[model samples]
Target: MAVSCVRADPRLVEFNDIKIGHVYKKTVTLFQFTAASPAMVVVPGLLIPEKQEEVRDCLLIHVEDTETIKIPLLEFPKVCSLLVDSVLDFGCIAANNQVISKHHPITNKGTAPGAFQVQYSRDPLVTVSPCVESLQLAPPSG
Candidate 1:
């Protein structure tokens, strides 16, 4: 006798279906750089729990790389908490596979730049063009 099994790929899993406040582990990198050159590897042994607490480490690095260096990343359900300048309502969008475009701006009201990722949307019809964005603002000149 022969038997076969099928398993769903975790990589293909839709994280949006997860309930709020679910704890999960994700690997992140932190870099130590100089004004002259970039480093080969980021600082290691830095671990933090995915809770709603501010992790203050470096201000300069944050200003340089907003897509990185943020503490306690607001991924998963927390991503939904992102504050948009205004709500987007695409009522009765074109059908028959016709694409429509809407432009919006995201603000970073911090001393450092940050990253925002559009993992998934509640509406199947809604999608982001450049799924990920870096929220970088100019650093204070000394």
Candidate 2:
């Protein structure tokens, strides 16, 4: 989604140069996640579980080439836990998705730039949305 800097919070920054709509000269894909499919792919070995969920049903954009690809994430609830378990418990399985988690600097432990440690903060951003704090979706285990 093309976002602008006009968002009330500066921390949630946006690109000023890019416009807020599909920018395709000839073959621009206006993907609408109007429906969910059962045969979606999960990428845990490639990325974090939480990160994988964010890209579900989201459209991807190649800034330079304008080559867009629709990323359809795991739709099944069972698949969600399994994919999440792989990443959160073991590792991630990224394929071609360009987005990533945070970037860990050279001094940090992770080998890659996006495998940074989770930084927590009690700042106003956390309080931006109420449901963000209230809803906790965890499966109960025996």
Candidate 3:
């Protein structure tokens, strides 16, 4: 007797090719349904026509120079669940001594007031990276 081995056809992977830079313009609804301990079902997911669903941890967004991206929230409950990761961008610090020095322009004797401004600033645009991390429920930490 010989042991038999079979693998699913590789061509099946091409069913849907969702990639970076693909923007989902439609609203996606997520829900959970439970079955008794008598059973459990894990749905890998489905392929549909309108949009491809992706589960993400970190999110990326792209917008044209003129348009604004908006996500709507109806109430506090929604906000409580949303997780945000914040990164500090370039900002000005008072430690820098250089500042607008001169108050008067005509005297031209002492350092001119408000002549130089001491601060760091930049146009901070956040590049969204696909977040592979998802939140999980676990026992409470003591």
Candidate 4:
């Protein structure tokens, strides 16, 4: 004997394909629905339209509970590269050290150019050149 899977009730599960680099949202209004054993809705891997085989961390879904759970699928592209460190630190400088400075770069590892703003605390001891400002990064092609 072979076990045949049945289609989910249309009234229960509903989903639509989303586009990359865009946002998709749905509002589900339920009336007096009881879920004895709430089931977790897990979305495995979201397909990338451009490169179907390539898998990237782009979509995220959050389900609160069983009955009143609101499933909103968020889709976003790799607009900004991943920054391992947000704060750049300069090691303690010697009292006699003439010049104490550090060069930190905000790299854009994403497919598109990443926009960033630099901000730092006001400290008389430390000097930050190129005051906190907005800047854009060219997309890397290597």
- Top-scoring candidate (lDDT): 1
Q: What is candidate 3's lDDT per residue for 1-142, written digit by digit as tens? A: 4332222112122222343344223232222222311222222223333332333221122223433223231111111122233443335445354532222211112211212222333423322222223333322448
| Alpha-carbon TM-score of each model against the true structure | 0.33, 0.16, 0.16, 0.38
lDDT string, candidate 4, 67-120, tens digits: 233333333344546453666777776868587677887565654444555566
Q: How close is candidate 1 to the true structure, as a TM-score?
A: 0.33
**After superposition on all CA atoms, how large is the RMSD of candidate 3?**
23.3
Question: What is the Cα-based lDDT of residue 7 in candidate 2?
Answer: 11
Instruction: For candidate 4, give the lDDT of residue 81.
Output: 60
Residue 111 in candidate 4 has what lDDT? 46
Q: On a 0 to 1 TM-score scale, where does candidate 4 land against the true structure?
A: 0.38
lDDT (CA) per prediction:
0.45, 0.27, 0.27, 0.44
What does candidate 1's lDDT look like per residue over 86-138, in tens digits?
76666676577777787776666454456787777588877776788786664
Cα lDDT tens digits for candidate 2, 1-142: 5421111111111211222232312122232332432232322212223321223343243322544444332221111111112232214636374534432222322211222223446654322212222222233446
**lDDT against true structure, model 2:** 0.27
List the lowest-lDDT window of 10 residues for candidate 2: 4-13
Which residue pairs does candidate 4 place in steric collision?
Answer: none
- Indicate which candidate wins on TM-score: 4
